[model samples]
Target: MKKIIILFVAVLLLASCENQEKVNKKADISTITAESITQVINELNASNSGIDKFLMEKGVKHVANLWRDSDGSEEEFKAFCKKNYIADVTERELVFQKISRNIEIITGNFNKITLELLEPVHLNTFEQHAIDNEFGAYSVDSHWMNDFYQNKIAFIIALNFPPFSLEEKEANAKEWTRKQWAYARLGDYFTARVPAELLQEAGKAAANSDVYIMDYNIHVGHLTDAAGNRFFPEDKVLLSHWNLRDEIKANYANTNDGLEKQKMIYQVMQRIISQEIPEKVINNGKLEWDPYTNMVYENGKTIEATPEPNERYQQILNNFHANKAIDAYYPDQNTFIKRQYDGAKEISAEATEKIFTDFLRSDETKKVGALIKQRLGRDLEPFDIWYDGFKARSGMDESKLDAQTRKLYPNAVALEADLPNLLVKLGYDKERAQWLGDHIAVDPARGSGHAWGGAAKGQKAHLRTRISEKGMDYKGYNIAVHEFGHNVEQTISLYDVDNFVMNGVPNTAFTEALAFIFQKRDMLLLGITDDSPQKEALKKLDLFWSAYEIMGVSVLDIRMWKWLYENPEADATQLRDATMQIAKEVWNEFYAPVYGVKDQTILAVYSHMLNSPLYLSNYAFGNVIEFQLEQQLKGKSFPTEVDRIFKQGRLTPNQWMVEATGNDLSATPLLNAAKEALEELK
Candidate 1:
């Protein structure tokens, strides 16, 4: 589950200085020329009659590329391949199966070790010691790749199961059997040889970012206005920017001071984004601050405060440098951008951009925005992008919902106990629901909750949800259900899949799609069902509006990464300026007309932009996929259909869509639905 949604730290940790040095030391080995590679292929094929010409050429070339000075001269390379290459298809398959099984065990245990080590840092249990931080920062798999290379396991896998390019997979995957897909996944193992030291450094950088974001809370109640008026409750502490954003949405139901609170929260977000916030105000309750005027005071006395000094952007820059270091090893998928798209997501960046752009620029976006404006009885503000009116529970008072949720789930254990019943409400049989629930373990999260899927069979997927001592609030419960959906998907795809290699969905977007599905149904789980005639229409409008907001953010994220690549040497301050510029440009082009505002920097306020790095797109993609899947689930058994579709495992995104929904991924469904809903609403 860790790899499903979170960044793949295990893979990143495989990059080390040892592998770089190893590659560097063999730089002078010019004996293995193209002609020599060809000759080696010819000799191998001649000696092993069962091995075809194509296999011979691919295997020899693969081994030759990975060959080092320690791997011996050109003759020795040829001799090793000739000796170890399995000529028979059946024999080669057996070798692949063996390797795959061993890798799953090794990698699974490594994931378990990592989860244990990082628990103190990741979860809010006790005051974290320096040793705890050090342990959390450690990457257990840092030396695994280097060790593999030294033991020749990497070369063996590469020589036997040659890698297929993304193009090759896309072209032939639809025709491939499950076994064939598994083989291709096996081939993905040793494509890059980064060193242990670099991998460890990357892990440390990511851990630092995680800790920074986790501890970034605001004492919302301590915020004061010009007249020293406090709008929030004294005990209310919210994390930036998820909890703060959610609080803004929750205030939409409050007519008395909703707008004021929302405006104040927006101001807080802007300061964070611009790095103009006072250093002492973040996660501090000792001082009262007025976000609008940027004033800090203790007991009614104004105090001088320094700005945050661009530390947020510094983490992003560090991540960029760490990721950029591994580019040289991935000659084919060199950049982190390429790795995210072609390597990790297995979708082209061009395709993702096209999907987002076409949807954002469509007439449907304008129609939806106009509808929101009409509902609000005024023009849209920047924060109206997060308007929650279309949801079934939007009209219900949040306090009532919170009261119900806190009573139902008094703690993490309470929610964990109810997972089976929740699954049952989603249409699973009692026995199956119990079985599925048994595979997931719920815990109180340090930050806003995230679901971490188990890495191997028999491992329980961890569902972390934020729960206060009083109980789980409405916001926490909603997020818990969303993460529970991820846990269910992770449990199914890993434990029930046809093969170990193909254990997850195509990408994080797919998992996010499922999570969104469950999140929209949080009310149902709480025994609150909407029987409104406009329910379907409201759902469509809601999805369209959500997509409209996030697509702009996604575009901003994509542009920011592109800018970073263009200005790789940029300092944190320069990066901050560039980010603000990009945010404003995206806002003006896409959101200005809708909101009646230009040059807004609110789109740059996402914490993921600094911590998660290039993750905003997945949320947009998830909405699109969720809309499509929602359509497919109509007039069908929900649990049965979800099981059938998700069990398809990690196919290419389009192919997975085709098999699951009888259509490829497209915005046409959501846009058309929105148009119909607009008509219905009118």
Candidate 2:
């Protein structure tokens, strides 16, 4: 599934990864001086007698950093800190428990509200309207930070449980208790006092971009070649770029027309990337388009058509501006790129870049590309980056699979009913499978599928996927399987984990790892097992190639954002041009030698670029994690291992991987496996 990040969950999962930098202009609003902060800390420790002097100093300094003129005068700030800071261990534990419970209540209900409001915009249950967009864009919890500050709840949390930087968390995580981790997570909540209006604006921008992406469908059946040859069924409409990309993958099974269809689809992708596609043809079946010539026809007559305005790039800029608006609020992690990489993923941008580039430049990458070219009996096209030939179902007729899936899942309800059974097929006991199924609510989606995890226990995680009027097709089923993996991880991490504050994986990549695990087993769940002797080799090759493909795209995503930061004032057209150039540059570096082609813009066609900023790396990282976990699960009980690993819950990526697989997160395992797989296949 082409997934969208659940931003609400992401916000709550912030680990506040940076120490307070020197007070900038925005942070200079604080009236409390450093001398007053030190005086308070010393006074609190002196009175408490046995208090942790380290926490006293850290907590006072932390509060002062967040303190503003509105908070109080210097004396008032000192008094508030002394009064609220809990020094006794027993009392501190009690306060932590209470704070954690109340936070869950506030955040959980806010999530429910957002989910309900977005139902019309996100789900297929209702017709979309302007009002739906307005409601969807509304951020109910935007005022909660300000409200918490007014009640001194924010200050209390900050003072009692001082925020830890990524370095501190990693260094201390080995020795800290679970409760200490929870305390650090709570401290993460108030590190930034961004105004409610800025939060609402960012939320509005994200929602608008999502709505635009959800509705951006391409009427593929209306697409024709120069001789007026139409390849797809008349009713076929595919959304860009999820369904369109999937369509290319599906055509790999079409023995006769597969290459031709792929080339045509590639042409269509180029048009979309260049914004040369006719505006009238988007989401409209009334007009036919010859993507090759950038010409449109109405009722067999050529019609003058205007290309789509740079609305795609405009969405990118909208998100950029929204992020930039609140940049000043985050003193340590000022840029959205920094916040996303350092705060959200808990991995530095440079480290992530090195990891991806290293894998892209691996000898195994070239070997795999060479093997793919050999399998195809020809040179690879740029679209061949998504070549699906390694999987068991690769050459199997997709129409047959669609027919099977359609019959099995006639509607969303049918699939929902079978969730437990699917789990059973994966070695889960009946009771456990039923429990998981009961907590996951499946819904038909308007866009490509995504998994929205529950914020609190007893709140069901949502699995949303596209279902046609006729039934669920193979593609939808495949996506649902992937999303089902997310729901399983969600259920495990929230309901089974040790801490309420640590109720998710380290990042979305971890959840995506679990999702990939489930997706690889879709055919098995249907009793179509791959018993090939070379199955292990194929699996390794599949993961290696998948990682190679997305890592390149991930690199492009990073570069594009870097470009945006460099050219903050650039408009849509300029941004579009820059993005295309970056995509080509990335392609040339990693893919040109393999494909025997250069300057292909196919990597830029991911829908995520416009909607889900900086999310492509998660997919690449997911592939890496998935491979490592797969290796670990080699001889272990699948259900038991999955339950155990995911329950580790919100540790740093490296820590979680080490605990789960007894190895750090690295491309070496995958690359080594691919090398061995090559030997076996040979």
Candidate 3:
């Protein structure tokens, strides 16, 4: 109001001056002091921030649309800068044509985003930029990549796995496991290599942004969730998954030089579903375990046995064991993705008992029948499903019982500023932690509560986040942990890229490896551990079990889609049928063999298929690497030695594994974690 009043008075004074030229001269001649200029800049940003956000979103859409073949002849809308131009004399209109003739990737000739253009560019400096530009959307792409690949190659050299050149393929279990882990780790390394040059170019462009605003588009545009939608996230799943075919899952099935990651991973899968600790899986003595593979054979005489250790069960496991679906994607035991799989699981509704007493057994929910009648509350809507989940987590902060995180890192300008100190506490040294401190920035923007991505442009990179905000109450905090992993990579890669092109990891999972590392920080933050609290045991079980749950869904995603592709005749209905069958198959193999669960399709609620193509694997990968990194940090601190390791930017994923943990990123961490949990349960 005061500003408006002042403006009105200024306008009146200007109006009283009969000459417009004089007013213009006065406005231009008046010099603003530095403090006033800073104030104005802040105020202007506060007012125009919405418009800026709107433009960024539109820009992202524009970039996504540019990947399409515009008219079937490999022509795309925005594959390159528009150059041909002409002007009309009287109307002052400009006419132009785009330069998009040579690009084939945008025309869909390739489905993955591998920087294949640079695969052969090793040793040649002059022609390297050529390949980088071809693979990158911008020019500096080569600069970032050249350095990134070197680190990957160096790491691979150290691992000393025998190379597979599509020739000498057969290998033993141990050999195959080594190969599977390497390929899985390297797929991202090479893929990220392709974009190294692109990001390098992007950073350069970002630096000269103000002068090039008209030509360039936006960088980090996010979307708003619709009333019935939170179904998607910033479309990040898609963006992150965009070039997956060339990255992590390129040779997804044939893990070790075409031997098979599925087979290696599957070896343990069998143990999880059927291995027990001396008791049968029973729900009130009911015997509902599947009897397919759980049989006994003595001296060539076969006997149908109860589901037990060392026995296989059902079609999914049987098929996997037999190499039928060995190539399938299975993230966990309980949840697997099959397009048609109606995967579901059960949990107790917190208010079920109260609802049943009032006889308000409407169509709300079988569990919560009385909330509407007894307490005047509404029906058990599906949206309220997470009420119990959030409450369980947020309940920790019943009072202002927590200290402000900023107190720990007084040097930090934001909450993210606290990351270094926290890292040191968890195990980082002060200097490296401070170096990390310098690279990150906390935006305080309303993030969906995930740690969010870090953007690196020019010599500096900044990390921005919107944690501790609305809707971010607890779930957001959990996500904040996971996101921190992503931002750490962003900070490391952007600020510490080897040659600028080789400055970051090779793929989403490479960053995921780090984010996975950071996410473990939450328990560290609360000072909780293996012996912390009674509830921690249950929470840990939920965490450990949830990974198993997701493993099934992840497998379903890989398998069902391949099934659909195999059976082109199948529609949505056919797809769903095959999916449900796979779900039940998996349940019988893992859960039924132990917990006795069946016909559960709750896994379908996962948003990946609706948004991303091959993201389920990342969660599984995170769990896997979490084990590796945690082992590395188990006794030592991070900032003392790890932050520099994290800051090493362009290390191929494997190199990072060796440098950070002195081992390969593998299933051992997670497998050990699970094994430990099982032992405790005993």
Candidate 4:
């Protein structure tokens, strides 16, 4: 899975934007009068003559914005602010430290609770039950924010540390100390006082979607051509999107029929995109499916199979509705899109779009595509969008690698045992590796693997991946290694950062960057080193191609959401059509010229689109960051650099990038390196 661990409480806290008047009409929760806010600020400023007037004004306004009638009367609200505001710098720090300590306890334990509840659904530990879905979807922390407000804890924080807008944060970033940044993050919370019910409902929608995607597996073994020829193993079952895409990559080693198998997988992906796949065939091995004909057979007899009734699109629509429910509550950010980009990711949607599109349309893209075509000695097909030829693993027998991995890691425990050894292979000292390994827990995943970072220092980050009874296959091993990268970053960032609030990197993309770095060195950890003169150049080419593929998917996801917001009332079928259209449009614009194919819906096959909501861009951004960091890591101590870089904590993306590598995050480095690599390889 491209997704890392999602903090459910953070998800609930996140809010979007709407028109101020529209928001007021919907909730009208804030009841504090303008006169009351001014009076409170004036009184506080008079008593604490040395306190910053601007801070006093901002804190009062911030608290007043989120003050609900249920919280207290205007007089009570004024009294609460006057009584709680910390005027002295030393007292304010004390308050901040106490709140941070309590927040970590609350968030960490809540995360642990969610992890435990999700075990049955997320891990392959036991037989699943219907109740598992309900339990997993339950939002334990939904009412926490409301409780905070009612107890006046939220007011105290807002009154003392008013939140800063994205613009303000960026403008003052250079001047703000780490403690100031941590305080600003505190300000980020309690600004949006969304109802607990809406939060729970949204969490339910997201959880259901997660379950839907996790359980969506295709019995590829049961798939056959019209001639009754089967290509995949009889026991082979692949999850939608992740395993299917990996299967396509693995097949490149099949010199005899690689293209044929890839085409079959592409056909399967199209059926999934169009929702024409037989519903009975999904996650059911007894039924036979011929994706090309969109037919199903039971007991070798033709059977009538209903198409999956836009359920894929329904998941997206559900999430859209769930998030839209809380739109009115966020006075500052009215749209979920804004919250996702500006609030959570700390990157604006417009800048992200430009980054992706510019890289997608770059001359390097076609140059790389042309090189891939020359290597293949054939006309490009749509599935060539995921061609993995540039990687060193290309043309290697994946089955042999699978066998090796299975032998090496017979179970999750075996992998867990070797975590430190793997880290040592990356140049970390044995002691440091052992510390990281002790801090990370590995488990058998029911779905494709993901890294769920720890919410606090003492809590162990979890690396969950699929492992068959036979053993961990190469695909699982590869994903495990990637997640290990995330675990390492998550551990260092949380435990080593000076402030509790600055516990993570800027966003998920930064973690993804580390994961990519670790994944690229997978073979080296296995004692398989490439001494070829073209090794460095090949690496750049691979990164360029990987960026090209994921960036298109990211662009598709972005456009799909834009369409969703524009036509929010559209039903599932309408969403299906709009999504597919946007996918094709992205394909035509960025991929058609390279592939000599148009209208391919392959980009729409990412499972993340249904659950993670605007997460695909992180992969695109991660690729760029990975390439740039790899450039900076030349001849450096890998583990030392990673530890130092991640410890910089939750600065803005560019700030973190510059501090880490003396350069801002950009695709320019990757593009230029790819241009050089192309010439070197030629």
Candidate 5:
């Protein structure tokens, strides 16, 4: 799932033809002095005796900071605040309701329009044209912020609904009512006034990177060894990083040629990371190539091949520059990292980092690693970070599972049809399950599947799952189930929540938690039940091990972003080297002791680094939340409990966790369960 930018809600009203003179003048607004802020506040307070000093100070400062010379002089700023400021609690609440309702209508419609416009780029039904690509990158709402500022809609919001810091929300949220929460969320709407062109450029960079990743497919059958021996079937094709990694995991039970296939996939990943992968070998099955030797051949004749020229790192560089450009607009949460955490996620980066670091460095991680080694009867390799032995399906042949899945879900429609049945299998009532299923639409994805939640109440949440022409294979089915979980969350949170302003979960991690819950039951939905007495124990270990691996990747992602901020002028090559070093350092510190290996760059191979940008951490956070929810729902009704919990809607992470599980987000439960599971297995 892409990280939703909540602030975009305020900026989705851009006019088609912006006044360039006004925009040019507004550029000097950042130069507004501290004395100017004080002057506006004192003058406004002096005139408005009904308004409190706190409100006067906050409203004036927020408005003045965004006040351009073109907007008006300081006198006009004071007059606007004095006239618009609502002093009565009841009156202010009425104003909040009106603004919130209007925003929902505007943002919801804009979201629908944007989603429809990008269908050509997002879906793979036809060859995307140059115009389609450009259209996809062109954000219709990019100029909305500029338009809002020019028309004083943004200032009205700032003046009436003063923003709260994340800390303030956390500290006061417990005592706040539903209306108060809605008001606070409204405050979140207009904190920053980024230039429309910068937002458009950022969108373009993201769209281009997304296109690059979506098209990055490798012809597995065309892969040749140093001895010119083909291992995979002629028809097999896999997307870089996702399917390739899944293929490696799927082969752990293949005693005949699985290890060799795993080795080859690892080689391909290394080539990709080092930018030494053959350019022609990507998404092209017309040429035969030896990944290990970096050689290409056509019709049994040698062919020269060029490397990919660091295009992967170039995408990351573009995202970094684009995000960096907007830093100035966000004075409080200046960096992308800060905005992702404090603004969107409502969780501090430092807190999440500590949680991950503590878990990765724990002795429980070593116990799970040792258990994996014992299960494999061999030393762990870098690729073993994705070890699949803990999964029940690991013992079964992937082909048999794939055959079953293919037969059951022959197309996207088949899976969509069965969503209610799958939900029922997880203990949801038939009626509610059917209702949820009706709100979800499944589509074939061009790349690895992702779930896109509907922005409006009636809009259907889309589950874009990758389905081969042959059918939905086991790996694709597994991912579809995971994405189905996202759709379910999206549907429930949007349609069932009490307030439209508080429709979604707190952050992506919360939805990811629900997705993990649904994903762990994929086998149950397939009528494959494990009656092992140690089933619960195995589940605990699985969650622990998965969390352990992703936490390392998450740390690496955070460090990479920090590195990018430090080296603003660094090119793609420099960034790549620095990324590799950071990945190795993270592995050596946290993973080497457990895996008995050092200096591995495999942790840096996640495709999100290039495309999603700082999203990998949510997976780790999701695992933690999933484990806590799992513990709470041990004997509870799955659907009832899920609905009860998720409908709480957009609280701070800790507060939401406390309401759902009676505790804050912690790794101790998982760690404790892993310890017990290890003992039981022994």
Candidate 6:
């Protein structure tokens, strides 16, 4: 077991890009003076260099740190910052030098079109400000279901560069249509998340929550669930979070070779992930989240990463087990891609196969031993096993999480049934409460994981971006709690701030703070506690286990990208070998000492490496912030205090954390916290 818990690529937040459905709707905000709106929209979009050169990059210490060095390691960061003279944020100064604002009116126009499409439960829009274009302000005034997937797809559309194989103009055009269709489908999923909430408690009654979401129709055009009409959907419901993904994959899988391309991409990624072929790997994909990644498999097999290396690989592998950051770059090699991947050894196939065979022996499969084929079929790809397997391991039934969440939050449609409740709980009331919740949770679906959308306050409409998690589990629920926390924060900040457009928080990490506040409730929500000494021990285990798991994987993500950039033309086998070498190196360094495992890349079972790129950093960021906030919230009577922290959306993560915890985003807080908890284990 390694440290990392969450998986996937570079995700900050959407820069409010456009999602074109090829149809425009006139909004009711005609009285607000279109000329004035157009001027502001044009100003934001027309800058030549954008906010006077890296308006997105100014004072961006935290964001800067995440991308500090090409190496993507702790040492590289220190050296890079020292060399570049980058300044970390101070405790008192609320610096958000890098919160991105899409100056392109096209981005604003995209929001406007989305706003006009809202219906049913309109989010409060009048009191809250929103980014408006020549068309109208993107209001979160009405119920819009398919918001999650839309924003996720939109974010991709906005950042996706032309494929190396395709023409730039053609690529952009294709991306435009791709964004629109993805958004159109995502609207369906939001309805799914809500309906799932409603159905969880539908019970024998006619006016149950299922009736609520079914009435909402999360996946608009499809009007169905992944499990089908008879499943959660026909029950007049869809489950939130977990099941919501089922709907998207089942319902909206792209037909025009899009989803297939994604599948191929994931399959090829297995070379990096499972086979560990590349020896040394790095992503020049320049995809959203780029991480330096590496891989090594221990079938009791040995590959000499460096010359004159015999038991040295064993020593490094042992150190890697310990999670100590070794400054060795593995350099370049003629015989091998990197010093690590250059080895002249290989683990026997039988030993590696033995390990996998044992995993298959678990009681997880119902058909049992008859299933010798672990990588079953196309549907049962190796990655599917990782995803589905872990899901089954989670005590909760994959189908039941949403049903259970609904039972927890009644009197409202979903957990976020009404965004304003978060504000109201935080101490705001009536107009202020309604204004933010309805607006923020209801913004047009811009692509990005867990992006909270808001319409102008007082106006009635709703929209929500996707809270992304496909191969996620109990951890994903924690992530969902955090995402919901962001939604709550978006609700409050948009409602509270003066400038509707500038009302919300800046950067992806602020909402992360809000989510962290909520995720602590994992054990609390489960009604478990550090009661018995045994239970307390278990709690510590979960943290260290997740962290240990994630860290190695994070190491792989970074190493792989670095390899790719360095070896642009490494064939597929070469890619697999490179990744394997790094994975082995990371495992040896991080986990070997702690768990006493000789070699384990089990944590590499992350989907992010398959899909979203360079994204593992945020989980590290989230863990850091969560630990920092937990330290502050420990003895404080922060009952509704969490809400106030959330409402300060767009405050810039660095500034928000400073205000919330009087600190900057750093690993020390988490490291310290983990150490304390580990001491309890002692």
| Residue range with the least summed lDDT across 10 consecutive positions in model 6 | 14-23
Tens-digit lDDT string for candidate 5 (614-639): 99989998998999998889898888
Residue-by-residue lDDT tens digits, candidate 4, 349-374: 89889988998999998898888889
Model 1, CA-based lDDT: 0.87
- lDDT of each residue in 31-143, candidate 3, tens digit only: 22334333433443454433333222322222222221221122221222111101122221110001111111222122122223322221122243433433433332334
lDDT of each: 0.87, 0.89, 0.36, 0.89, 0.85, 0.35
Residue 560 Cα positional deviation in candidate 3, in Å, after optimal superposition = 2.5
Candidate 1 lDDT tens digits, 30-53: 347787787777777677775667
For model 3, the stretches where C-alpha displacement exceeds 4 angstroms are: 1-421, 427-431, 443-472, 526-543, 567-581, 644-659, 680-682
TM-scores of the candidates in the order shown:
0.95, 0.96, 0.41, 0.95, 0.94, 0.41
In angstroms, give how far residue 141 of model 2 lies from its true place. Answer: 1.2
Which candidate would rank higher by TM-score, 3 or 5? 5
* Residue 296 miss distance in model 3 (angstroms): 52
Q: Write the per-residue lDDT of candidate 6 for residues 1-682, one digit (tens) a residue.
A: 2343333211211211111111122111112233433433343335422232222222122222113122244443333323332122231111111111221233344455554533222222222222222113122212232232233322221111111111222233224342322222221112111211112111112112112222221221112122222112222222322233333333222234323323333333343245332322121111111111222212323223311122212222222211111111111122112212111111112322232223222222222111213322233222222222111123334345544444544322344554555445444666766644455433312221244354445433233332222222343344455565666665566555433334555444455555656655544554544445544333333333334344446556666666665765555556555766777776565444333344444445354443333345445445555556666766665544665565543333445576666776455444444445545644
Instruction: List runs of model 2 lying over 4 Å from the truth.
Output: 1-29
Off by over 4 Å in 5: 1-56
Candidate 4 overall lDDT versus native: 0.89
Q: On lDDT, who's better, 2 or 6? A: 2
